[model samples]
Target chain A: MAEPHLIYFADPMCSWCYGFSPVIAEIRRAYGRALPIKLILGGLRPGTTEPMSQKARDELAGHWTHVQEATGLPFNRAAIDGEGFLYDTDPGARAVVRVRREDPELALTYLGRLQAAFYGEGLDITRPEILADLAAEFGIDREAFLADLDSRDLKQETWGDYGTSQRAGVTGFPTLVAGPNQDGAYGVVTRGFAPGDQVLAVLNQWIEGAVAQH
Target chain B: MTAARRLPLLAALSLSALLAACATTPPPKPLSQGRGAWSFAPANRSESAKLAYGIPNSDDVGLMLLCAQPRVKIWMSQPAAAPPKKIALRSGKAHGVYPLAPEGEALLQATMPAADPVLDAFAASGELIADQTRLDARAANERAAIRAFRGACPAKTR
Candidate 1:
């Protein structure tokens, strides 16, 4: 039987992906060695400086409240509005790239933490100090992490990943791709925030089909 | 011809079983059901007492969200909820009714979007699905927006 690889493409700043974290983790633990899991960064809103309009901000705040109602995640809009922080996600994306170089395993964890810190706790992740604070919270060596943040290598890697995802035509965050192993490569694309059951159902169907082909 | 002949029958059965398994289609999932901790009272003065979240409007057909926590109640007046639409929750993003209606997912998709604490309080006091968090936040955001909108639409208020 050919094993299937499941790839989750997402951004750390994405709120929906953050909500899907526990469910995905549960699925991974449940499926354990039966399937291989891969994480890809789908860069959302890269290189944008214009601050969100008040109307847009209010709409987002309401949306956050609704999300909290559904998922039980915290959201303190005061913190979001207190500081004059532009919702620039570039710094946070750069940080994720930095962590990928040092500890590839923890890249997704960093993404989750950053999402929670910004969306949940309303921290301004764009600021370097705040990013360092988040890194410290995760017990990562701040000095090493900071050095990576400054590295040209990390910056290039972030841009490179962004370009690849764009070329792949990933329009949004939290896209999951699962397909058959084509001689060591799995190519399946599951898009958007689908229900856990839906995701599992899709995988199961694909697996059965693959077995028939074999 | 006794035991040796039985092997072919067993192999036939195995192949049939595998083919059946391959042909089995998955069962459709049930619709996701759970009340959002928030809902809203109707905006029409005649139906204002009726609590709702996504309600239709007669005019320019925009989106509106009307919700009530336990203590507070408000409506997203500028953009209103249209029919064939319901506010729903997904991982983090709030997709409009069109994307969610067919899927029947949660209406409030925030990370802990509802005011469960307040809901619990009401529940303890013998309230049925009185979402306190939804009510409080809904009221707060609504009041603030109305104040701002009123200022912006001063001529229309009277």
Candidate 2:
């Protein structure tokens, strides 16, 4: 028999995942340690090389507007407007992986901060220094986080999460999966963004269903 | 193996490999209430029809179809951008080709006229393919929904 837990497949650079941050927080507040939620970076745009075309950047800005309207999340659309910016998601994902190495408990909290910094504040998370600055806020040594974020091994490990997400059939961001109960079966909580209330209702039912198995 | 037998054996192995590749492709998430089905949003007084191929009222959808009669538009979610800017649609004998444009980070889009035979094939055919990715194909009642939507909205007001 395996313990019931949640796995969140998300990317810090994904706008929808940024929108879903509050809902994940609600889940944590409600369930606490009873339902441990694991975070996995979905690598939405890892290692992107091309400088975004103006049209592409405009499209991204439109998406941020839609996200803001739907989730009431603040977004700095100018983030995509910078000159010749490479929208690579690898470095941001590595920061979370490095933090997870230090303390599993800090992963989710740190992820939320990164989302807020990127979408909310328009900080360039693709840069190591930006990632290091965020880590310092959590009392994580800035120098160590940069070293780990820059290390090839950490990049490989962070990418491993992307592979896990693909193997698990997660095609969209903010995908939440729960389970491996006594029968070793799992169920999807939400494959995309859901209202916090709807997510809580599902979580409540999952808890009931798991308890019923007892 | 003799040459005749070797040729047949090779063909068999290649066919199996193609089938396996298609089978290994991940399934697209359903847009409406039921998996393996398309859900149509209520068509207002207008002649345009908007249908979603993923979850209802959610931003994370697999496909979205917007039809206003002789013209039909499709927005598909893609995992990555392809180099080519055209979408080739295939369903059995029916084939449709359209210019493909990226709508956003994960969405690729194409437009076609309603009079196009490919639209009919999409409504009746049990399978669909766009570019290299396989879309949700089924014989569920949602096929009727798609037909109704196509009927109510023809690219030009009928």
Tell me, by TM-score, which candidate is best: 2
Summed backbone clashes in each candidate are 42, 11
Q: How many angstroms is residue B65 displaced in model 1 relative to the true structure, after the best TM-score fit?
A: 19
What is the docking quality class of candidate 1?
incorrect
Instruction: Quote the chain B TM-score of every prediction.
Output: 0.19, 0.61
Q: What is the lDDT of residue A39 in candidate 2?
A: 91
The positional error of residue A198 in candidate 1, measured at the CA in angstroms, is: 2.4
- Tens digits of per-residue lDDT for model 2 on A86-138? 77787889999999999876989999999999889988888889889999999
Question: Cα lDDT of model 1 overall?
Answer: 0.49
TM-score of each: 0.54, 0.72
Question: Scoring model 1 with DockQ, what do you get?
Answer: 0.03
Candidate 2 has a TM-score of 0.72
Q: For residues A81-193, what per-residue lDDT tens digits would candidate 1 score against the true structure? A: 75454655567888987776666557767878888888778777877778888888778788887777757877777777766665654444566665334433444444445
After superposing candidate 1 on the true structure, give the runs of residues whose Cα lies further than 4 Å from its correct spot.
A1-4, A183-189, A208-214, B1-158
